[model samples]
Target: MARTYHVYIMSNRHRTVLYIGVTGNLAHRVHAHQDGTGSAFTRRYNVTDLIYAEPYADVDEALRREKQLKRWTRAKKLGLIRRQNPTLQTIQGPYG
Candidate 1:
């Protein structure tokens, strides 16, 4: 079976911060973020809400998209998220 790659976005409750990341295991990564074990930036910003995620068959594609999103302005990033989540509320993680 082929492994999947994901480009994911996380945010704090107040939507005051955004974090973009690429991971081979979305569920594990999300768990880490929620538990404050993901990264210094995420833990420091209190960005634990899983907001958006996109899967890719290719790791390169996922990495490239992650890099692209990280470079975007906050407005642009929010626009992308709004396209899928108009209400901009916290989204359930991919896994239960």
Candidate 2:
């Protein structure tokens, strides 16, 4: 079976901080974040909301996208998220 990769963004409830990450299993990765085991930054900032995600066929592509997004200005990142999720709602659960 072909592998799938995901580039995702997580934000705090107040939307003050954004966390970008790449993973082969988005659902599990998000679950870790939600469970407070993902990263120190996410845990400290309380950034568990999965606001955005994009799928890629290759891990390299997903990593590249993650790096690109990480380098973006906060405004640009917010714009990107807003474009896909205008309401900036928390996207969790299966396949999140």
Candidate 3:
């Protein structure tokens, strides 16, 4: 089976911090963040709320999108995410 890559956005409960990441296993990666094991940044900021995600066939495409999203202003990022999730609530269930 072909592998899929994903670019995902997550935030703290207060919505004060945003995290962008690329992963082949989105569920496992997000679970790690939720458990404070994803990265120094996510752990330090307590950013574990999964808000937005997009899949790509190629890892490079997912990585490039992650980089692009990281460079965006907070307002821009929120805008993009709001298109799918207006309330910015934690998306439940399987996102992969």
Candidate 4:
């Protein structure tokens, strides 16, 4: 079986803070965030909403994309999210 990876962005309720991460199991990872056990930054900022996600067959590519997104400016990140999620709504499901 081929392993899949995902680069995802999470945001706070106010949509002011963003958190980018790569995970092999997107649903589980996002659930952890929602449960406030994902990361210190996410838990502190209440960044539990799934704003954006990109999938890749390679974990290295997902990690690279995560790094690239992390290096991007807030505006750039928001733009990327808006391009796919115009309203910035929370994506609820296995892959959103």
The C-alpha TM-scores of every prediction are 0.94, 0.95, 0.96, 0.96
Judged by lDDT against the true structure, how good is candidate 1?
0.90
The digit string of per-residue lDDT tens for model 1 on 1-96 reads 999988988999999999999999989998999898999999999999888888899999999999999999999999999998887788875542
Q: In model 1, which residue pairs have backbone atoms overlapping below 3 Å?
A: none
lDDT of 3 by residue, 6-69 (tens): 9999999999999999999999999999999999999999999999999999999888999999
| Per-residue lDDT over 2-94 for candidate 2, one digit per residue giving the tens place of the 0 to 100 score | 988999999999999999999999998998998999999999999889999999999999999999999999999999999999999988567
Worst lDDT window (10 residues) for model 4?
87-96
lDDT of 4 at 88: 99
Mark the regions of model 4 whose C-alpha exceeds 4 Å error after superposition: none
Could you tell which candidate, 2 or 3, scores higher by TM-score?
3
Write candidate 4's Cα lDDT for 3-94 as tens digits: 78899999999998999999999999999999999999999999999989998998988888999999999999989999999999999896
Positional deviation of 72 in candidate 3, in angstroms?
0.9
Q: Report the Cα lDDT for residue 62, model 3.
A: 89
What's model 2's TM-score?
0.95
Measured on C-alpha atoms, candidate 2 has an lDDT of 0.93
Q: What is the lDDT of candidate 3?
A: 0.93
Worst 10 residues of 2 by lDDT: 87-96
